[model samples]
Target: MSNSKLYKGSINTIILKLLNEHNKMYGYEITQKVKDLTKGELNITEGALYPALHKLEAEGLLDVEIAKVDNRLRKYYKLTENGTKETANKLEELADYIKTMQTLINPKLA
Candidate 1:
């Protein structure tokens, strides 16, 4: 499996969390935000970003708005009602996972 595979499973959660914090964001914006936040440790590629966005939209957890910018259309994503709820749940789940990882990776911290 690819190194990015580990982060693949949490893509939705990451997207939801970002949308939860920011009202809406475009695809490239999201990628930049992640890179900036992680200090370039995590870079979200187009291949991984779009599919996850479409999946979340299809699942009714995300809402999209298209706007004309610089003579081009830009799609911005935000959390829907269900997505807001899901974001909270996903955040909690991520927190739990972090705790588990901490225990496993640094037992002294646990």
Candidate 2:
């Protein structure tokens, strides 16, 4: 993200939401997809992304698949059952956060 601090807290939620929508994705693919979806307004870096992935895996919110493509192994991530549920909850929380922030920023938006 261009303004990563503002977005850092939502990285896991973002990852889960994207995995929910796309089913499965590799690390670089996830980065590219986020970039494309946000029109480059957000950029997920390796420093930020992998640790989040590992954390989700440790939390049992994600599953990893390893596949060989032309002698190179690639790691793909997908949402687990718990992850699906979490995604919905996180999205709702994010939406509510946006609404609250909007209200605070501009009471007319409330």
TM-score per candidate, chains pooled: 0.92, 0.95
- Candidate 2's displacement at residue 37, Å, is 0.8
Q: Pick by lDDT: which candidate is best?
A: 2
> CA lDDT of 80 in candidate 1?
97
Q: lDDT tens string, model 2, 1-110? A: 45569899999998999999899998999899999999999999888999999999999999999999879999999999999999999999999999999999999969
TM-score of 2: 0.95
Show how many residue pairs clash in every candidate, following the order shown. 0, 1
Name the 10 consecutive residues with the lowest summed lDDT in model 2: 1-10
Please give the lDDT score at residue 12 for candidate 2. 94
Q: Identify the runs in model 2 with alpha carbons over 4 angstroms from their true place.
A: none
